[model samples]
Target: MFNKGNKGLFALVLTLFMLTNFVSNAQEGESIFNSKCATCHAPHKDMTGPKLFEVRQKWEEGGAMEGSLHQWVKNWQVAAATDPYAKEVSDWAPSAMTLFADLTDEQIEAVFDYVDEQPKGGAVADAAGAAGGGVASNIATEENDFGWIWYILGAVFLVIIFSVGGVKRQLQELDEDADKQVKVGSKVWVFKNRKYVGIGVLVLVMAGVVWLFLGLYQIGVVSSYQPSQPIAFPHDIHAGINGIDCKYCHNSADKSKSAGIPTTNVCMNCHKQIQGAGDQVEKIKNIYASAGFSPEGGGKYSGETEPIIWNKVHNLPDHVYFNHSQHVEIGGIDCKQCHGDMTKQNELPRVVPVEELNMVEGNIQLTRPTLTMGWCIECHNVKEVSTGTLEGKGGYYDEIHKRLLENDESLYEEYLEDGKVTVNELGGWECAKCHY
Candidate 1:
């Protein structure tokens, strides 16, 4: 409560302080409302939760218990059991609203004040959504981006050139001081030490040739490339906490070469009821808008729809032959072996680097970068051939192992010395195995 004073200077200062405090609280309340409450409770629209505009008046008019509304924000269960009006509010929805036991009474009042102050829709909501996306994209793009590496390399090269030029100038000065002829240019200096210069040039030319081929090798490799997606999906929360298998969303992995992108109906399987939390609700709204799903009373498909443009994450070249079904089902390779542990991934799908993939506890360690031919070949060379691991199986493994022993005993024993026959020992390293 604010205290009142009668005197001139003291009263004026006290009034100014109270005004400042009120403004600060108002701003805080608005921020809290936008972050926590705005998802379900809007000012004008009755969304997932009821429209909260002047809700306090309605509660008070219906004879709410003193400070029960604030207590409800703190914990709905306790409020519902103790307060009659809060009990009535609990039956408003079948699913329970998320508890906000962390918010204080002052904060709750501020949220209410903030919600009341909002002038119903459009510009404000749009601005808020844009601001959130802009901030999130900037931060995430900054984190995993590699565009800065070239700039850093350029700066390093500039420094080296300056340092070398400085050293050359110093050598020229020393030659002048000693009354000896100074090599005025790079050509003159090279001529003076032609043998050493020739050797150095040869080494540099070989290095450049190697670098050119290495750059050409990486043309089709997409290691950590993450493109922007319309919806920000957190794989960690879904795949990790919820224990949803990769095959659930990517159902075609066991049947087809391509693991299909999930349709909007797949999203509706859960989001028909679970409207999501925070800014995620708006993203879900995009799905709803595209599916032409109206969730006013319950939900219904209007038979009109729009498309959601999803960029491909992992793309293989047309010339390369990679089968998802063969690797996932027949070969018994885990998705984590190639995709990294998606359970820990929070951002949109990215081409997981080989270094990160190797760091996964059970994954096979490899030296080459991800999505490169060398990387694939390296994996095939170390990954155990199913023929060696099969104990009682009477399929391809049994026939292949029998043939290896009967036809080529020496070669079979040589491979057996390592105790693990690799895929390369099978036709994995053959030109047609991947190239075709």
Candidate 2:
């Protein structure tokens, strides 16, 4: 019923509408792909699963039945039974593909459209593997790398001394009356300046003693000592991005002597679905092996387990009776107070340097190296004890608070003159408190 010009206009509007819809679908598909499919499958790279790029076309070219690809996405096992091409894909890898039963046919098609649009060479691969290792394995190497700088300076100093001595010798040889002057051998010169030499020797011996003492003081100082673990756990990703609480993994921090390493069962809670992509594929596979889990047949426990031997990061002397529960639960100290801001930590867990710990916001500034006796003593000297509202709680601090208030009024008044009670005033400085 419409004119030829009107019909042409209608066709133009329809084409524009379809193009806009396609663009919208592709954008939605990108979001879905990142949140769900990114854990296992990549657009162009084969990770735990095969590459998704051009997969729809490949299925079609291989004579796949209509709507079978969408069915394969929804439930691959059902698709493999009905379609010959889908069955071939089932045998593509030892690990089975994760089923997306929640996705609609349109969403499944949109995912394919998104995958096909991705550039084949590397962009897709790069984008897919975005959440890679937060910290490098060799990050600790730079912390103790100042020896080379000292070596370079020493070499420069030797060069300057030699150059000056050579210049002086040249000037002496140029003198016409050089032979007329009395020549003194090195031994004769030393004998003439014996007093100065004795002073210099004393100074050198004193300096050597000081240097030796400083070196011995640093014998137990383990700042920035990060050990290689079975799996490179990314604290930035889990704690920073995901906002997982510290207590969730180190469950015994408030109850035991040590903040225990999390078991594989705890890892399986989330990783059962997140199989991982690119470089993370192998790391996640190690977790799977430890947990006795198989991604095949929509993920299951095969009961064939392997232990992940994780190297301990922190260590203390046998004589030190440090209790994790006493400090964490009673003191109410934040993990960051000692551990630094772990949320932004990119590398493997290491003994955080005192300088780095001091830099963290709200942390008490201390000069002593981390994990040293001096560091603990410094913390106790300044750390305020909470005595409020614990009168009837029968807690250790409550009893101490009662004694301060009731036992000695003059001593309590003197202690309060500094504004608050410190751990040192409440027997924290007692040798037996930390020793026995």
Clash numbers, per candidate: 0, 2
Write candidate 1's Cα lDDT for 180-239 as tens digits: 555465635644665674465345435543543354344334678665566778899779
* Candidate 2: residue 35 lDDT (0-100): 39
Clashing pairs in 1: none
Candidate 2 lDDT over residue span 209-265, tens digit each: 354335434433567866556578889888999899998999999999899999998
Q: Per-prediction RMSD in angstroms? A: 21.0, 24.7
The TM-score measured for candidate 1 stands at: 0.54
Task: Specify the poorest-scoring 10-residue window by lDDT in model 2.
Answer: 133-142
